[model samples]
Target chain A: SAVISQKPSRDICQRGTSLTIQCQVDSQVTMMFWYRQQPGQSLTLIATANQGSEATYESGFVIDKFPISRPNLTFSTLTVSNMSPEDSSIYLCSFSGDGKQDTQYFGPGTRLTVL
Target chain B: AQTVTQSQPEMSVQEAETVTLSCTYDTSESDYYLFWYKQPPSRQMILVIRQEAYKQQNATENRFSVNFQKAAKSFSLKISDSQLGDAAMYFCAYRSRRGSNYKLTFGKGTLLTVNP
Candidate 1:
């Protein structure tokens, strides 16, 4: 398993604001994923971030709303744009290595609260 | 598409006792993977156990074990000698082994409470 960390741990933002959550992994991984867990809800895949290529968003997620950046194998960022109360949720990042593609290790998660 | 379901919204167990959490999934593919992830109040997703669909034997990790019934599409986690640290939100996840379908589908989660 890889050691993963997220920046800011948590944050509170006002409506219409934007916040960027950074996910850093200890080792290089092939695929990085971003997931959103809304209040009392299950985890939802936001997108899949692959190094050197544009991210692939899941259904109901768009580039304009949740922009992702995979600058390298071990780093990725997910920015929540035009935030509202409905956007408040815990955002998490996970990664799967070459030999361990079936399993994914997760970060601590960034807890966002919109006011 | 795959869907994971955690039927129990909440479960309680006395400390040092055993408890079982139920999970069932719907998937057309035969080869797939199921996982039990624990999220404490800290909100970090921790992998508790994993079971590969092809394997017949169940997976065991110390006191944590899974009962995987491939035909029944049922996967359940049994915790022995439960402790305070064991109380958390348990989520059942399913992933397809097919190519290009690497996303995980998670259940709504079962909040486990360890009563002292």
Candidate 2:
């Protein structure tokens, strides 16, 4: 199991403003992922952040709205761009040990409230 | 695409009693993994149990255990000697072992309440 820490545990922002959430892992990992959990809803995959490359966005999500950055294996960030009321949700960062392991360890999650 | 389903939206169990949460997944691939995660009021996600598809034996961690039925594509979590601390939202997840993509498909989740 890996220890994942996310910054700015909770934040409140204006509707038009954007917020970037950071995720840091205690140890280096190969793959990192981002997910969104709306109020009273299940989690949905947002994208896969690859080190030194563009993030892979899932269906129904666009890179323009959710830009991701992964400069190294142990760290990644997800920026919620052009936020709206609908963008209010809990953002989580997850990672796996390697290809051999299938379970993911999740961060504490960043709670964003868009007003 | 792989998908996980948790039919029970809500469940209640008395303290010290046992409870079972049902989960089923759909995947064409033979090799995969299933997981159960718990999210309490604090909102922190905690891994409860995990099962490997290739392994025939069920996985158990103290009071938490899994009933992995590979042939039936069913994986249920059994919480024995439930306590107030066990009250939380439980999510069933699936991951494809063969793909380079390290994404997990999560179920809708089941809210578990334990009453003393």
Candidate 3:
């Protein structure tokens, strides 16, 4: 089990502004994942970040809009660029040791509201 | 492609009683993993229980257990001695055995309201 934390617990930003959320882990993990969850909706995978490699984004998400950086095995950042009302959601970061399926855990989400 | 479904949107149960949350998934892969997550008002996704496709013995933790049927593609979470703290949004997830499938396919989620 890994303990993860995200910076900027909550933020209210005006449209067109960008916010970068950082995720730090207690231990070095092999895989870091980012997810977005709209109010009262299920989670949607944004991208998979691995150290020293470009993040693999899922369909309907682009690097220009949601750029992710995994500088090392224990840290990563996700930047929400040119935010809009549609981007108002809870951003979550998760990590797993050895890239296993069950040892994975999630960090407390960063709630963002684009006004 | 894989899909997870949680037919029940919301369920109410009395405290100290048992409650079951249903989950069904569609996948072509034979080897996979199923998980149940709980998200309370805090919005932190917590892993409640998980089951491997190859393992038939149900996985149990304290008061949380799962009934996984591989041929039926069903994984349900049963919470016993439910407490008010157990009230939360429950999600069902599926993952393939392949290492490349890092992302999980999640269900619509079930809101469990534990009434006093």
Report lDDT per candidate. Answer: 0.95, 0.92, 0.93
- Computed on C-alpha atoms, the DockQ of candidate 2 is 0.82
Chain A (candidate 2) TM-score to true chain A: 0.95
Candidate 2 residues B5-113, lDDT tens each?
Answer: 9999999999999999999999999998899999998888888998999999999999999999998999999999999999999999998888586678999999999
Q: Among the candidates, what TM-score does chain A have in each?
A: 0.97, 0.95, 0.95
lDDT (Cα, tens digit) per residue for candidate 1, span A7-74: 97999999999999999998899999999999999899999999999999999999999999999998
Best of the candidates, lDDT: 1
> Interface RMSD, candidate 1?
0.4
Query: Which scores higher on TM-score, 2 or 3?
Result: 3
Choose the strongest candidate by DockQ: 1
Q: Is candidate 1 or candidate 2 better by TM-score?
A: 1
Output the lDDT of residue A41, model 3.
Answer: 93
Model 2: lDDT equals 0.92
CAPRI-wise, candidate 3 is high
Q: What is the TM-score of chain B in candidate 2?
A: 0.98
For model 3, the DockQ equals 0.87
Candidate 1 per-residue lDDT, tens place, B1-116, comes to 78888989999999999999999999999999999999999999999999999999999999999999999999999999999999999999999999988899999999999999
> Candidate 3: which pairs clash?
none
